[model samples]
Target chain A: MTAYALLVEYDGAGLVGWQRQSNGLSVQEAIETAATSLNGGATPLATAAGRTDAGVHAEGQVVHLDLAADLPPARLRAALDFHLRPQRIAIRAACLAPEGWSPRFSAARRHYRFRILNRPAKPALEEGRVWHVPLPLDAAAMHDAAQALLGKHDFSAFRAASCQAEHAIRTLDRLDVTRVGEEVVIHASARSFLHHQIRNLAGTLHMVGLGRRPVSWPRELLEGRDRRRAGQTAPPEGLVFLGVDYDPPLPWVTSDRA
Target chain B: MTAYALLVEYDGAGLVGWQRQSNGLSVQEAIETAATSLNGGATPLATAAGRTDAGVHAEGQVVHLDLAADLPPARLRAALDFHLRPQRIAIRAACLAPEGWSPRFSAARRHYRFRILNRPAKPALEEGRVWHVPLPLDAAAMHDAAQALLGKHDFSAFRAASCQAEHAIRTLDRLDVTRVGEEVVIHASARSFLHHQIRNLAGTLHMVGLGRRPVSWPRELLEGRDRRRAGQTAPPEGLVFLGVDYDPPLPWVTSDRA
Candidate 1:
């Protein structure tokens, strides 16, 4: 058996998140089905660094799966991409994995970007890819408020009720908010995230950006540790899984076969 | 009667071209229908600066129309936008046009951008918004070759066969190509263009970027003055009408009611 890692990108619209469920089609099921076809009837389980929710897009998602056939990385990637055709998914690259490497548990950080179209008119070009807020937002104030949530803390106030994680304690390495033209962009990085943590944070910061809450609001919510007191969870359409960073770095593989 | 100008933005995925046609829904038809309803059954003809082809997007298209009702600019804009819902079009701003103003005739320059996704993987998020080219391209080479087509010249080589322009001579103001990460971006500007000129130039420059043609090939094609000698017309999906420039600048109007 050969362990391989694949870099994936997908549009999460109309998808049932990353996990396989009987409810609807999923990113995991789609990739696994394609990989199984290539493995000639043997099903291979694929594990990703993050199991993104439905309507959440990804630019650089990492996945690991073991295949019985030891095909060249380029050939396997091309074949898998071919089978996954007509679906909104692409295998950016594939490479032989280091022995015992895990895409989910490998020691490193993950990054996400949340986009908000802060304009009066509804989005045309960026529909389904951004959270449209007709009201003007103060990005600088949001960035100031986001600073209070950085570092280690019990983020229970921002954790989803359905989150299965045992503990709400996590370290947030970065949270930045900036305006790029009509879009308010927020970048967040951490070792891992509890379910809906970024969305919750984005929602809470939005209130601050709109001047509905003071800059001290996020810190107060963190200390209170009450989920109901926090703002509404921002919609999933705006969140994107940017990429993952692995410690000691995995071998960089080129998609070019030549 | 009020002569009004609207700044428009739209996603060109489903609509026909800007012109009104009997076969399919066009951007012009969508706006006109909405405006006519607001005008109480009287149809208002809309004229745009550029007649963008089907599947071509626009960031800042200027349009002029005359309405019988003399409503406030912001209220009129809001009403039009409210009626334009469920369609992939937005009225960015609306204002009273100066007397005798024409969107097409009074334009000083027009800007367009073409995007090429230079990567091995097919696009997932940007699928229909960019042209995917699997082969590696040298953006610098493309830019270098494009410099030869600058200034006034007979550009019959790049004009489409069906182009109805009386003369093939046009003064090209700017044609620049640059690489942005995994995408190659080309920006072009001119007072006017012959049909399919930018696409043809892009396709020809693509050959130079691929090292398939010498850097001097664009100049040779231009001097040859043969439409058949030029490269294929790049697809419409990759092109965007950036905006139009009017000299003696029109008054800037804000969409905000306050």
Candidate 2:
């Protein structure tokens, strides 16, 4: 079996998240099905650096999988992409991998972006792709308040009710909220996240945007892991996995399994 | 009669150009009907900076029209925008114009943009927004060749077969082509354009991009002037009227019935 990694980009609207599902279509299912056809009956299992939520998008999602053949690296990537050409997702880059490489565990820091478009008109074209926030937000105030939530914290209050992590403690390396024209971009980086953590944080930060809650809302939520104490979970549509980091030179290792 | 200058933006995918017609919808008819309904009596006629062809978009299209009442500049713009809300077109700015401010006669120069998405994908989300040209393109060569056609020249070769312009002589102030990742943006500016001039230029330059035509295509086209000798007209989807330029406090016209 060859362990390889691949870089991916996708519009998440049509996907049932990244995992395999019996009832709905998923990125994994699509890739595996395409791989089955491309490899001439060899079935491959695809794993991702992050199993993004159903409506979440990705510009640089990383994945790794084991292929049964020692096929040339380029052919593996090319054939899978060729078969999966019709799909919305794209395998931008791919390469061979070292043995035992796991897209999830090998990832060090994951970057995510949440977009909030604050305007009155219901985004006609950009709708369903971003959060159409109708309220007037004070970006400066929201930014100043977001600083307190930086660094390590218990993050229990902002934790989701369905999170599977054993501990709610995590270090938030950064949180940036800024406005450009009618759109507000929230850039956040972390080692990893508990389930729904980013969405939950986005929800509470929105309150600060509206000036409903003080800037301390985020730090307060981090101090309290009680899910009930946190703001509502932000919509999944606006979140996008920007990319992942890896030790390079031996190729991306993030093979395009499909 | 009140004179009003309107700033408009629109996605021109559905309408059959900006003018009125019996066959199909035009942006002019939509706005005129919408404004007439708001007037409660007199019918209003709308005029635009450029009477764009079908599938041609505009980000800043200026126009001067007559209204029945003396509405404040901001209020008039706001009301017209609110009334034309349902249409794909949007009125970004509006105000009473200085007397005799004609969108066509008063305009000094016009700017247009063409976007070529050089990618394999058919661009599902941006369906009617960009033109997808899958093959790789050479931006520098296209730009270099494009520079040869700048300034005053008889562009008979780039003129459409049905173009109504009496003369082929026109000065091209600028022509810039640049590649950003998978998209190539071409920006062109001039006093006016012969019908299909930009589209024809794009087609000829595209040949240069693919190394199919010599790098002197632009100069060759400028000298040829024969419509039959030019390149094919590119699809209208990729073209946009960036804006129109005028001297002074932005076109405050005093009379509409003059």
Candidate 3:
């Protein structure tokens, strides 16, 4: 069996997110089904860099699946996209994986982006693509407050109750919250996170931005560690998985195999 | 009767253009209904600087309306917006016109903007707001070709067959086409335009960008007075009535009444 790493982009509005669920549609099921169509028999099972919740979007989601076919990685990728097109998920790039390569355990970092529309009016065109908040927000105050929560921390106070992480201790490499025009763009990078960790932090920042919580609130929440002390979780609509990183870029050529 | 000028903004998808249509809803009908609701009496008549076509958006549409009430101009404007909130067309501002103000007759110049989305992938978020053409366009060629048709000329070939203009001779103040990333923004201004003039120009330019026509094609079309000679009219979705001009330096207020 050969392992392949595939990069994917998708519109999450039509999805139940990255995982397969009995309730509705998902990106994973679509890709797996598409891959299975090319392989003739075995249903393709993929492991992603991370499992995102319902309503979350992704521009660069990395996944890997072992195939029992002689078909090339590029051909496999193209075939998968052909079948996945109806599902709104696209396979951007696909290549043979390095020795023992896996999307989940082999990733070194992950990045996420959250967009906030900071206007009194709703988005006329980008309706579901952004979080439309009708109230004015102080960006500087939120940025200053966010700095206190940087570096290593046991972020339980900002962790969701449904979080299944083995430990709450994690290192946050960067958390930049800045405003561009009428929208707020939040960039966050980390090794990994507890369930809804980044989303919960967004909620805390929104609280600080609106002057509901003091600027030093995030640091206090980190130190507090009580689940009930966390700010309300931000909605899933505005959050997106931007990318996943692994050191030593793969030298495999995708087109040659196809 | 006191005449008031109003600056307006609207999402054109819901409008059957600016004129009253027997087939469906029009921007004029929407505004007239709201104007009548703001004050008790009869429905006021509304006229705009330019009667934009169906699916053509506008960020700054200049209009004049006569109200038979003692309502403050600001309150009249705000109340109209409150009642018109259920509709897509919004009254950005309303003010008492400086004596002898007429939306159509007093206008010295008019400007129109046409946006072209040239990308391989469709804009999922901006579906109805833009016109998506997948083919790659040569922006420099389009710009060079556009200059040949600039200046005073009998734009007979560019004017629609049913254009009501008494003469085809009109001086074009400006005709510039530039690129912004994958999109091309065309800016053209004149004292006034013949019906479907800009759309006709855009259609011919599109052919030049695609290398289907020579740089002199736009000039050739303008020199030829036959409507059947020009390229097809561009879709209305990608166009916007950017702004209308009056004698400037009047406090820079966006109020409809200058």
Candidate 4:
């Protein structure tokens, strides 16, 4: 048996998120189905570093699965991708796993980017890909206020109502907001996040950027440890899983040279 | 009556080019209908700087229309944009034209951009926005070869079969190719272009970048003055009308303060 690590990118529109659900089609089911087809109708377990929500995009998502038969990394990627055809999922790279590496547990960090189209006109090319805010935002003020949430803290105020995490404590390494042309991009990196932590943070910061809420509002809400004290959760459409980082690196990186 | 110059942007995915067609919806028809509704059901003429092909996007398209009632520039833009809702079009700005300014005739230069996704896997986010070439391409070689077609010369080799131009002679201002990460971007600028000229040039440059054709091949094809000697026209999906320049700047530039 071979444990293979795969790098994935996908458009999460119309998807039922990363986990398999009875509600609709999912990115996990798509990959598992493709992997099953490649394994000659045998089902394979496909686990990702993070189970993203529906309408959330990903540029560099990591997943790990075990196969009964060994195949060349290139062939494995090619075959799985071929099977994933017509879907918005792509296996960017694949290679043998390092020891007993698991995407969810072994992941050191996860990165996310949320895009906001801060313009009056409706977004056309970036229709479903961005959160359109007709009002202009102050990116500099938002960035400054975002620093208050840095380091380890109990992020209960930002947690989703249905989050299943036992503890709400997590270290937020970075939260950056910058204006790229007419769009405001927010980048967040952390060990892990609560169900809707990033989106809630985004929504709260947007209020500060718009001057409706004070810069000290987030820290006060964090002190309260109450979800009701924070702003609304930003929509899922603007969020994207940028990538995941693992310790000791994976063979998918070096396999390209070989 | 006032001849207003309008700055426009559109996503041409389901559009039937810039001109009105009986078969399907066009950007021109959308704007004309919107203007007619705004003008109390009286149809108005909407002339564009260039009639882009179907599936050809535009970032800064220019258009001119004569309105019976002279309204404030802001109101005109707001009203037209309000009416153009539910369509993949945006009136970026609107202002009175400079005397007898016409979008096509008074335009000094037109700029276009073509995108090529060079990768092994199919692009998800940029699926229809770019031409996916599942092979390695040398962008520097393409850029070096593209310079051979710069300046004025007869370009029948790159003209479309149904091009309705009186002469094949045109002054080529610039043709530049650059690599942006995994994508190859081609920027073309000229006073005007023969139909499908940029697409054909991009296809020819792709051959040069792939090492299938020599760098000097474009110059040879130019000298031949035969359409059969050049490469095939690139798909319209990869093409975008960047913008058009006029001698006296459009009123939107000066009307911003007022």
Winning model by lDDT? 1
Write one digit per residue (lDDT tens) for candidate 2, span A12-32.
Answer: 887888988776888888778
> Which of 1 and 4 is ahead in TM-score?
1
DockQ of each: 0.71, 0.20, 0.18, 0.46
Off by over 4 Å in 2: A1-4, A20-24, A41-43, A68-82, A118-125, A134-136, A226-232, A249-258, B1-3, B20-25, B41-43, B63-65, B69-89, B119-127, B249-258
Specify the poorest-scoring 10-residue window by lDDT in model 3 chain B: B249-258
Q: TM-score of model 3's chain A, to 2 decimals?
A: 0.95
CA RMSD of each candidate after superposition: 1.2, 4.8, 4.8, 2.1
**TM-score per candidate, chains pooled:** 0.98, 0.84, 0.77, 0.95
- Please give the range of 10 consecutive residues that has the lowest summed lDDT in model 2 chain A: A249-258
Candidate 4 lDDT over residue span A90-197, tens digit each: 888888888878898998999999999887666777778999887778999899889999999999999999999999999999999999987999999998999999
lDDT of 3: 0.79
Question: Candidate 4's C-alpha lDDT?
Answer: 0.88
Better of 2 and 3 by DockQ: 2
- Binned by DockQ into CAPRI classes (incorrect, acceptable, medium, high), candidate 1 is medium
TM-score between model 2 and native: 0.84
- Among all candidates shown, the one with the greatest TM-score: 1
For model 1, residues A68-137, the per-residue Cα lDDT tens digits are: 8989888888888888888999988888998778998994999999999998788888989999988889
Off by over 4 Å in 3: A1-11, A29-113, A169-174, A177-179, A189-199, A226-232, A240-258, B1-8, B34-36, B62-115, B149-152, B165-194, B225-229, B249-258
